[model samples]
Target: MILFPNAKINLGLDILRRRPDGYHDIETVMIPVPWCDVLEIVPAKGSETTLTVSGRRVDCPPEKNLVMKAYRALAETVELPPVDIFLRKIIPDGAGLGGGSADAAFTLRGLNELFALGLSDSRLAEIAAGLGADCPFFIYNRPMLCTGIGTEFTPAEVSLSGLTIVIVKPPTSVPTAEAYRHTTPSIPQTPIAGIISRPISEWRGRLKNDFEPSVFPAYPSVSEIKEKMEGLGAVYTSMSGSGSSVYGLFDNDILADCLTETFAGSAVFSSKL
Candidate 1:
């Protein structure tokens, strides 16, 4: 089976408090973008499962890849046949695009179909949650208001259908752990879901990402990209998650094209939401 796992951007992220389990409580809106990675799984010839990756180069051993981990997680519950997993990665890693999490979620869905596991979405999501906090969102795969370390989700009534979204990933990485270490979690004055309910134009002043305060100071380039995007006539712009990748939402297609050309050297993607 061939599956294309899509990427997502955080509309607004807020760290509410630190949890007892070493994870932070968060409130955020996660929205899917057209950017995607391709994955294919087919029955292997031998008893051993195998993985081959291509495109944009995954920087880890194949065994440690989330696709492999997804398979292992499922294998523990059900009998499975050997399969060859192929991944073509295009989404930038550690940019808070949820590329890896999408891959893992898609793998669980694919395996259920390929092996006839007959699992429900909730069941699959339960298993996916063990892979990553963001994994469950991809299973639902739509705009969601997320809380509780980003695992809990409710459908968000948001539609960016007429807007152009431009994403840019600078040549730097923001480790999630490091970003969290620099943060001081506190509840937001205005919750992201409430902010989103207002007109997109109003989002400029009310909607905010808590990560920007600490991350922007540490990695000025990411902040600069956000500024450049706003200067280029974006209706709204923000860092997707912790750092490194920034996105601009625009009603003007011409402006989106100009921004794409401006950041050609970096991994830039422009598409309609």
Candidate 2:
């Protein structure tokens, strides 16, 4: 089975509060982007499972990789054939792009199809929630208003139909743990879903990510990229999630290309909405 696991950007994020389960409550609108990673799985000759990776390096053991973890998790419930998983990573890690979670979700969906598991979307989502909060979102792979540690989701009516998106990831990686530690959870003046319903032009001052205050100070380069995107005539620009990756929504393709050219050393991706 071959699948392309795409990346996502947070339209607006608000950390509501800390929960009793040690997970924080959050409200955000997550939208899929064209940037993706290629994943392939084939039945292994032997009983042992294996994983090999190429493209952008993943600095972790194969066993710890989400693709392998997804296979093991499914194997515990249903009989699964041993498979050799190959991942060609393109999305930048620790950029709040949910690349790893997308990989895991796609793996679950791919395995269900590959083995004829016949698992429904809800069932697959239940299993995906165990992998990560953002994993369930990819099962639907549509714009959604996510809450409750990002597991609970409601389909959103938002669209960026004619817009062009430009994403830039700096060399720095922001640790998720550090991001949470530096942030202070609070209620937003306006709900993210509600804000997204308004005109994109209004998003400039109203829509915001709660993590930016804490994250921007630690990494000025990330903030600079956001500023530059705005200066280049982006309709809206914000840090996607915790930190490191910033995206700009432009009115035209020319502006998108201009912005990409401005950032030579960083990883840049431009595509239509």
Best by lDDT: 2
Backbone atom clashes (below 3 Å) for every candidate: 0, 0
Q: Residues 1-273, candidate 1: write the lDDT tens digits.
A: 999999999999989999899999999999999999999999997789999999987889988999999999999988898999999999999888999999999999999998888999998999899999999999989999999989998999999999999899998999999999989988878788888988899999788888899999999889989988888889999999886799999998845467667776678888877
lDDT (Cα, tens digit) per residue for candidate 2, span 1-273 = 899999999999999999998889999999999999999989997789998999999999999998888888889889998998889999999999999999999999999999899999888888899898899999899999999999999999999999999899999989988999888999987898789989999999899998999999999999999998988889999999897899999997745456557887899998888
Clashing pairs in 2: none
Q: Which ranges in model 2 have alpha carbons more than 4 Å from their true place?
A: 255-257
Candidate 1 backbone collisions, by pair = none
Q: Each prediction's Cα lDDT score?
A: 0.91, 0.92
How much lDDT does candidate 1 score? 0.91
TM-score of 1: 0.97
